[model samples]
Target: MAGVGLALRDGGDGGAPLFAAFAGAGAGLALAFSPTLTRAPATVRPEDAADASGLLATVTQLGRLIGVAAFGTLFLNRLESLGASGAYTSAEALLAGMDALALTAVAGAVSGLVRRRR
Candidate 1:
């Protein structure tokens, strides 16, 4: 009974909904960037098997935050260009887009590192 209580409070089934959302996002990103995030199922941590959905959820959420900060900064940077316009420009937008792509690549690298040893 004590164990059950611990499980419920410590991110057991109670956290299912949050994890589900994470997995949905993760699946989308994983599929979109399979070339980077792809790995053997066996490589995933044993704990991940219990909630493949949740682990993905957590990662996806954090990734989104990291991505937003990186890409947003790239887009909003004040710069002088376009004939001394000294204002927001398409160059920043383009850089932001590429930063997001690079972020995805880094996510894949993280997944590889987190992957369990066989």
Candidate 2:
């Protein structure tokens, strides 16, 4: 779901409606997984389930915050660089940044799969 959203954002051609749909799809997918993923650790460690769940949620939020902050900074810097040369617009920079993040995510997914196989 997020993969699809990222793909759309990376090549959305500045379409607001398409981005909105992508966001909706991604949100739905995350909502579908939240319960199961959040509950699994609890099942394994009942005594500390509450703490574990809280930690999981905290880490998840932190990961999102960090990803956005880091990528946003990168996007702004790239935008500025391109603007200085009169070579690119804000939309282009946004797409470029999204593409960068999408590629990184793909790499991370591949590495995770490889590690699991080993």
Q: Which residue pairs show backbone clashes in model 2?
A: none
Question: Which residue runs of candidate 2 sit more than 4 Å off their true CA positions?
Answer: 1-43
Q: Encode model 1's per-residue lDDT on 1-118: one tens digit a residue.
A: 1222222333235365546644555765566666434543346787776576566667868988987787566545522343267454554444445445556666766786787443
Q: What is the C-alpha local distance difference test score of each model?
A: 0.53, 0.69
**lDDT of candidate 2 over 37-114, digit per residue (tens):** 765685666788779878777887897899889989988998899899996667667767767776776686688579
Model 1, which residues run further than 4 Å from truth? 1-48, 78-88, 96-118
Candidate 1 Cα deviation (angstroms), residue 5 = 52
Give the lDDT of residue 73 in candidate 1: 65
TM-score of each model, in listed order: 0.39, 0.68
Count clashing pairs, candidate 1. 1
